[model samples]
Target: MTRIVFLDRDTLPTRPFCFDFPHDYAEYGLTAPDELAARIAGADIVICNKVVFDRAAFAAAPRLKLIALTATGYDNIDLPAAREAGVTVCNVRAYGNESVAEHALMMMLALMRNLPAYMRDVAAGVWQNAPFFCHFGAPVRELHGKTLTLFGRGNIGQTLAGYARAFGMTVLWGERKGAASVREGYTPFGQALAQADVVSLHCPLNAQTRHMIGEAELQMMKAGAVLINVGRGGLADEQAVLAALKYGQLGGAGFDVLGQEPPRNGNPLLARLPNLIVTPHNAWASAEALSRMTDMVEANVRAFVAGTPQNTV
Candidate 1:
């Protein structure tokens, strides 16, 4: 028998299969930091989403053999400590790639089309009273023939590049910084930012990428260029992003993630100007994607139980 405890079940909105597994399984909807020790005392598998299994918690769970991350990003887990503790840490990859890529485009479209301002006009009865054929609150730009700069070339980045291609946009990928050598078509990060009409971020958050897009990077962007971040929130400095929008360094900016989830009420970016569109980090939570996420988790757990590991971090 195996005990599979899922901490922070609220983090994942998907419903999982209730059927019998080969090993005894137990599911806890959610677990808090304080509850980790007691909750994972005898568990064989601990599933989590955004819940930190810190060094203390790892030391507390002696029977734990696996830490199942519900999403692609595993920074929430301390991988080095897990490895040292002989605990396998794994996360699903590209399970929601297409869904998140489309969502990123949706945010970009809203910014380009000024959807929010127009929607406000309709709700305020101004549109109904308008005698003109159209009202111009913001300039709507054509995506065709525009240049799209990709910050990271992972699954999601390539997926978005494909969408840009469909829209008749030119794509340029950003190369790693501080490397003398460069990929054939990819340009240096700095040059890509300077040349792009629209820049999309799809990189993970690491020491090298933390605040990768800051005031200096924003300053290098062409006037009136749009910025999109569908990657980790820590990649961009929120204060700088808000400042850029306020001063028009960026004509428009769209984001699916923020530095903090359910961000503090006083987050600088939340109070920024009209050109920003913020969603509640739902880019990867579509129904179809949720199903795929759960299916992958089941597969990973089954494989681990069968003396194999799949979809690892």
Candidate 2:
């Protein structure tokens, strides 16, 4: 019998699919941080979503053989500790690329079209006494004919680029490290950034990408261009973006994530910048994506019970 414990079940809002593992198994609905060690003590497979698997917790899971991360990123798992403990780590990949890419487009379109702001204005009765057809407190921009530049070439980024092309916008992307291979007729990232009419980010947060777009990078962008981030929030300095927004260096900004989760008080990112559009990090939670993720989880457990492995990270 294999005891499987999934920590932090609240990370996903929708109902999870029923477990259909081939071997004997137990799946806890949700386990908190404090209850982690106790619940996982005799578990052979430990599933986690944003739950810390530090040295202490890993040490306590004496019977743990396989650790399956619910998300693509395995940063929550301590790799060295898992290696010494002989715990195999695996993660689902590319399962939510289209789901996340669509979210990026949503934010971009909402910001450009003054959707949220106009709705607020109308709700406040300001549009009732309009002098003419409309009051121009919020300006709307068109998406077609604008150049869209991306910073990452991973699954989500590539999918977003495809969406940009579908909208009749030219799409370009930057290399992860060195100069990227030049696709025929495609603009290089460096060249594209300097000239992009709109720039959207889709890269992971790492040593090479932390604050990748700071003062210098912002300066390279053409003034009055929009910038969006659906990727990890640490790629751009929040303070720098605020300053740029204040001084008119950046025309508009949209984000589905922030550097800090649940965003701390006085984080300096909450200052009401009218041109900025921010949403809680729910970009990957579409119903279709969650269904696929559940399938991946089942596959992971079945593989482990069969003395095999799948989706190794």
Candidate 3:
């Protein structure tokens, strides 16, 4: 009999997580760092999303065989620690490609057309007194004929490139920063940044990529170009973006994630900038994506239990 424990069940909004095989399972709405050991003491498997499992937690759970992630990103878990403890880790991939690509497009379209400011004007009754057929408060740009630079070449980024191409926009895949040589299909990273009318990021955050787009990078962008980040929040310098928005250096910006989620402490980008749009990191939470994620999770667990494992990360 396998004992599986889900440390943070509230991470996913919709659930009744099912397993095809017979096993004993338990779930906790939320679990803090201090509660990890006690909650997983007797468990043979742990399932989590956005929950941190350190070396100590792994050492405490001698019977733990697997750590199943409900999301793609595994930055929250300690990989080396899991490996040292002989715990197999698995994550679902490509499940949210369509959902995330669509979200990046929505953000780009909204910012490019100045939809936020226009909507605000309409909501404030600025259009009620009708001076003419229509009213415009800011410059509206079209997607056609603009150069779009994508920072990641993964599934989500490739999907967005297809979408951009279908809209008559030219797309450039950017090579890694400071790479010794450029790849066949990728543009030199900095050169692509300079040529882009719209820049979208889908890269993972790590040592080399944290704050990859700071003040200097912002200065390199075209004066009126827009930036869209549907990836990690730490990829850009939030304060620099705010300053750019204030001084008109950046035409507009859209972000689906922040440097810190729930940003309760406060963030400069959280201000009501008409040219900026921020979503609560739900770009990958579409109904279809969630269903696929759930199905993959079940499959991964079943395969691991049957002497084979898939999607190891």
Instruction: Report the number of the highest-lDDT candidate.
Output: 3
Pairs that collide in candidate 1 are none
Clashing pairs in 2: none
Residues 173-292, candidate 2, lDDT per residue (tens digit)?
665434548766556656777878788888889898888888778888898788888899898988898888889888888888788888976555677767788878888989999888
Per-model TM against the reference? 0.93, 0.91, 0.97
Off by over 4 Å in 3: none
Task: Provide the overall lDDT of each model, using Cα atoms, as 2-decimal numbers.
Answer: 0.84, 0.81, 0.92
Candidate 1 residue spans exceeding 4 A from truth:
18-20
Better of 1 and 3 by lDDT: 3
- Sorted on TM-score, best first, the list reads 3, 1, 2
lDDT of 3: 0.92
1-313: candidate 1 lDDT, tens digit per residue: 7888888777778786542465566666777688779988898898887888778888999999998888887877888888888999889888988998998888777777777767877887887788898776777888889889998888989999999899999999988756588888899989999998888998878889989889999999998888888888888999998898888888888888889878976577787367888877888888999999888887888788788998776
Quote the positional error of residue 7 for candidate 3 in Å. Answer: 1.1
Error of 2 at 279 (Å): 0.9
